[model samples]
Target: MAKFPIDFLWGGATSASQYEGGHNEGGRGLSHMDFIRRIEKSDKDKVFPINVTKKMFDDHKTHENEYNFPFRRGSDFYHRYKEDIALLAEMGFKTFRLSISWSRLFPTGLEKTPCEEGVQFYHNVFQECRKYDIEPLVTMIHYDIPVYLTESMNGWEDPKMIELFVHYTKFLIDEYKDEVKYWITFNEINMIMNSSYLGGGMFVECSDKPAETCIHQALHHQLIASALTVKYFHENSKDGLVGNMIARLQNYPYTCSSKDVLATQQQNQFNYFPTDIQVKGYYPASILNYYRKNNIDIDWYPNYEEILKEGTVDFASISYYHTAVISSEPDKQEPIGAFIRNLENPYNEITSWGWGIDPTGLRITLNDMTDRYGVPIFIVENGLAAHDQITKDLKIHDEYRIEYIKAHLRAIKEAIGDGCDVMGYTSWGCIDLVSCGDAQMTKRYGYVYVDADDKGNGTYKRYPKDSFYWYRNVIKDNGADI
Candidate 1:
């Protein structure tokens, strides 16, 4: 029988921008995600640009019907937290990972005081989680940065944004210190390299700046902000544990060719650079050399090094969806997200969204992370996205999701048996919500199905799929049933 720790945190994860729909209520200001529009004919199978420009924003505001802004009303969790938390409690969840929207608290990024309603909203949510004894693992910042910061100050491109972010973090620390014990500094901090607007809130088109320079500069500031937040949590919170979250893409060589192998190694290094800085408290030499060679100038503060060293995270958290294979061949499948280019792997099955399904990759990632950092690793995000059909009887038999999660859980069991110190596993999108990649609700990834459509039409009701029951048993048995 497979055995997990007695205190293993088995639960689901969600982001405020993607799951909470009350964008305008509770005195919440606009977020960068609020300005992004869903482009026509955009699908996960094709590479699309997520960058936003002034023209696109203006067009979206005037021509609302022309674009679909699904996040503006994401699953309506802002209004339905009671129902959702009850459903999660029913699933026997020991924890629930969610993000606190920055705009909700500060309204604008430069606000001197946090909105009272916003502060109370989260207090109420945390209290509800406490009612069922579900630990709230809160992410301090997700992809949604305040739109004011991006538009007025060009986001993290300005060093001043760091102080503003720290102020916001302190507010959270003071307000929710007793309620939340587990804190994640940033969500997928490395994603700034790929989607500047979503990740760092920097408007790329309006300014005459090199994309790489802008991204790297913003990355440096975010790293510092994260470190400072970690230090603050440690100093103030009763017994808070802060973590650094990154999107972990395990890359493999397409073939035995030397060139392909070298490419794969380089890709891994690129991906690990951010984590290295966060964990080791300094920039990697290879990344520094790459920046110099590429002529990417980043303005670093004199005290930045000291801040990073003093504020290392307590743990490392990661979001692992699929593994990609890299090849030296010129004509290959285009890269999906930021950083790594990829060629399809022949050994793995493909999901509807074109991600390679490799359960063993999870095991490899766990072992690799623990070996490299010697830190407790948390599988913060892992799940499959698929299309679900509801019958007239209002039931969803999603056996495929069950199989996918089961295989991945077994992989985690193997990694633990191999002596990896894993903290917990929180599957991504515990409930169906808007997809971040293309803003589609049809590409659902949840044990509980949300009754909503891509065009924002449905009763907004929640229904549990077959996998929900399967997961309940898994959690109840502490993963032994899997």
Candidate 2:
């Protein structure tokens, strides 16, 4: 096995809504994620409506007390940061990736000044990271927008949101510039096309206009917002860098057919579109023609393209959990949500979530990215979510997860040995937090297990899973053991 670089980062990735509790505490206003409760509002894009709408968001807020919003009480990390950080430090983490909650800072996204309590809360978190010699990689925004902005400002649809986002993130840059260096503009910038609501806080399905029209318009604003945030990060912070991120949903052809290959190419092109814009600092011709073919005309400033060109990101990060198989034959496909009707990859293992486990795909994706962009790449999110079993001895023998991550790491090592400039890997949901997609806790994806359940019931205590110790040795050996 190839050894990792001495400066290679070994850490974990987490988002505020999925990891930090205290959703309503410290003067925090509700975000779109806070009101995400189960509703059977299925669309062609999904088997069930995993994404919420403005109405569903509002309704859930009205009936907030009637349900257990797992996101609101995410591992109670807002209170358990010290303990969790200690655990991660014990695991020999060199870096820690987390998001600063947008609503937590601005409350309603209209505040002239950030809630000092919210600001201080992050200060404390980053201070803890510093104590452990852990570099903090802060994501400016996750798949969350303040409920107030989404409701009143119509979220990213209104051009005003770009300014607001710029303002909000500018404050974050100024406040945390000294503590944080690597900042990600958005969690998944391209997600608006697939998950309009969670990606941009736009109720695209329920909008008065065409769904594509609304989505494209909102995405236009988000792109500009992202670009502007990158420009500001460069200007405000001396040693800081802003990077682009997306869910790297790599697809393989189901068969050796031209139709299947073409379909896969199109899907991969769309998947790479946003990052391409962020990295190259302009929209590609293919995506422009795609929008035209789809009859999607996004409204944007004439100069927005120049803004994107001026504010290209420093690096790029991706969250790759699994791969999908795309087939042109309809009968061969099965719906896996997000408007994707995919086929099974016989060569890959399957997760409980029905996602294809393709370790080799990660290496291929890494090499492709290196060749295409020629910039440093980081695997900010990758992990297996499995049903865990806690033994009578109270030890979680998550050998499956260990194997899953080990295989993925070996693939990463192969990519590195193949001369791909891969920077680091941060296992997603490093400490068990609420799962975002399913809004449940049972989809365990952490080295350390959280003693919590779907309804937010449990001791809320932390226990090291079997992967924790295994990963500690892997890090201690710096990829030599893997």
Candidate 3:
């Protein structure tokens, strides 16, 4: 049988904001994610951005941390990255993917002088990974943006955000370029389709500017930010690969009908068009037509064409979750089901969160991305999140998780066999951390399980589950025998 390339990296990924508890550690201040979690748990039925009642903060009857799920002081990776890296090393991982908290590096989000403590913290973390022979892959911005920036400037909607992000990124490159090799401009930059607040989508929502105008403006800023990041790092740094990540949620026609096919096409267009402009150096005609139909014309600045031409990425990075179904229906206008057809896939087992478990979707994503853009694709995040149970033997017998990963690996192998230019694999949330979309500890996806309760109370112990060993061997064998 064919095998995973000898140099193929096999490792797990986690983000600073998710796993690195010490939420208040390393000079890292509370981010928008903190506020987001606070409101979501207190009153489940309340629409987001509702008033944070004094009762919400002071109510002793509610869970500690004023939120139901555990986030602040998660697995305590700030204190235990060494041990975690050791565990990953034992698993034969060649690479480790993580994100640098913007707040950690720039405590207030706009600070000119970098925080010494935050810089020192990641410095130690990277140094430890280097010692263990694991190549460090860093993402500049994960889901956590500085709350100060969000509240004061309304997040990425402000053009100032592009500059701030670039400044923060430059600091990271100057500090760690000699050590770290792989970098992504923003994690899932295209997730504006889901919630604008999370992925520069709020830039449009909270703008005094027209909604379409702000969206296009935000897109321009993000594209410029990503391109500028690549241009600067490539020219200035010693050597590194820079790309933007799309949470590449693949989709299929619900049926073979023309409408279904059209739905998938439109849905993929919505998800991919913005990033395509960044990676391919120009917006597709279809996307321009999309904006025109909506009465939204993006303002293109002078020298914009030149910047894109000179600064397109060297690669495309993606996080493949599960594929969705798209059905064409013009009249549907609810917030969740409005844009695309995210119908249930009867063929696969779904998690409690209702995300389907279709490994084949991953392979399909790689193939489609390669065929469309003709650039190397990186699987930055892929995995299963489920409600895990710890057995009496003090082990998380997550065989189901192992099976989920194995099936996805198999799909990846098939994609490789079909000659897709694949780079590497880094499953999301390598060590159990808070979920980005759900903000729950119970939605656990980690090789080494952290002994923490959903209510945010536990010794914060780490235990290697069965999949941990399974993945170790998979990496060791290079996916030939998995």
Candidate 4:
């Protein structure tokens, strides 16, 4: 018997800034993503691709063609939505996770109304998804903030962003209330703890206060925005559901020692900080104590708790990629994720890019999250990034991807049998697109291959990999054979 429920969504995930081109069309304004240049392959290790500042963006505007902005020329989804949706339909997708570009609609973060052309684009896209019974799982904002917000107010640092973000959320809910039933408020909302720019749209160099201070304050405002998003989404859409997204950095203790275990426990709490606020409708005391001891004061609204309590989310979505080990010994720490510096898992084989290849981590994560939150858990982003090669017949024989996904799916099945409420799964980068880390298209995590290079140069044709047929069968049988 299949472990997955009949309504379980089997699909692929994508973000607008990572794949949707035509950033300048349909009255779309420049986003913060539009300003960042692609990192050269040789510079990927030394230079941070997203640690951007106001000065960097300003420089890019002045010297336009001197740099390569690969994201500006994405997989051309903006023009090929119909064709892409058809391919997904052919793969037997039940849901399609995608994001809307904020700047594409509002132009600037200050806009009271949206651009009609931009609104129409989504209408057609969502309608197409429905054409094949593919439910559109929409993310309202996925790392794409209008540059005007950062230029004027340093993005999320200012409390005024709450109002602006809430305004945008209302427009999306009111406009696509019927079209998009599943909405995610933000992508990886907790990443702000480390990456002030990508997570919070905060240019640290331009901030009036220290970066840490700005981040804590900005986090408060974003939490409020999410709560308000849930509030508005519930009131507006009778059947629509809202969710909170987190980048789940599942960490393990390096040793069985008490000190290592305690450190790992503390690290897990910090990793789950944002999810607790959104799901439990309140902050835990440990966080409060940390704030007090660190003197990280936030300007909380008078009715903040009330809003959080009332607007708790319907489900929790997370992006779980790899497992990083945490040790009490500081000297043993290395780079884990973009934001976290920690020890790597010694037991797991690692990817070429250093991500630990532990399919078992998914099972552990689902069980932990379910035990903690008692909410429906959606694996919104999960995939293996591999160097896929094309054979002589122009076929991509990605057996490694198949093996990776099969192991992960088995883990999901085990978690479900263990009584974890696993709602759905959407593998990340289903169609080859630019990697968020270095803007490289070569680091593929897709079942469908794109004939594009790192610099966005190619015919832009899409072909199904071997894993595509494998996934199609998995979805067809609802993982009965996994």
Q: Each model's TM-score, in the order given?
A: 0.96, 0.96, 0.91, 0.97
Consecutive 10-residue window with the lowest summed lDDT within model 1: 333-342
Pairs that collide, model 2: none
**Candidate 1 per-residue C-alpha lDDT over 1-482 given as tens digits, one digit per residue, 9 for 90 to 100:** 44788988899999998899899998999898887776656344544226676677778778866777888889999999999999999999999999999999998888899999999999999999999999999999988889888878888888898899999999999989999989899999988878777788886665566878888888999999998988888899878788998999998888999988987777788888888888888888989998899898888976998998988888999999889898777786344335434467899998877788999999999999988898888999999889999889999999999999999999999899888888899999999998787777887999999999988899999999999999999999999866
lDDT (tens digit, per residue) of candidate 4 on 1-482: 43888888999999999899898899999888887787666522533336677777779889887988878877889999999999999999999999999998999988888999999999999999999999999999998889899788889998898999999989999888889988899999988776788778878777776767788888888999999889888887899778999988788889998988888788788888889999999988878877798777777876999999988999999998887777777687543234444356778987767678888888999999999999999999999888899877889999989998999999999999989887799999999888888878888999999999987778999989999999999999999988
Of the two candidates 1 and 4, the one with more favorable lDDT, higher being better, is 1
- The superposed Cα distance between candidate 1 and the true structure at residue 295, in angstroms, equals 1.0
User: Best lDDT goes to which candidate?
Assistant: 1
Q: In each prediction, how many residue pairs overlap at the backbone (N, C-alpha, C within less than 3 A)?
A: 0, 0, 4, 0
Candidate 1 regions off by >4 Å?
42-44, 64-66, 332-342
Clashing residue pairs, candidate 3?
157-203, 196-201, 196-202, 197-202
> lDDT of model 3 at residue 295?
76
Q: Output the worst ten-in-a-row residue range by lDDT, candidate 4.
A: 334-343
Q: lDDT per residue, candidate 2, 92-151, as tens digits? A: 999899998999999888888999999999999999999999999899999888988878
In what order do the candidates fall by lDDT, top score first? 1, 4, 2, 3
RMSD of each: 1.7, 2.4, 3.7, 1.8
For TM-score, candidate 1 versus 3, the one ahead is 1
Candidate 4 residues lying further than 4 Å off, grouped into runs, are: 42-49, 333-342
Q: Hey, what RMSD does candidate 4 come out at?
A: 1.8
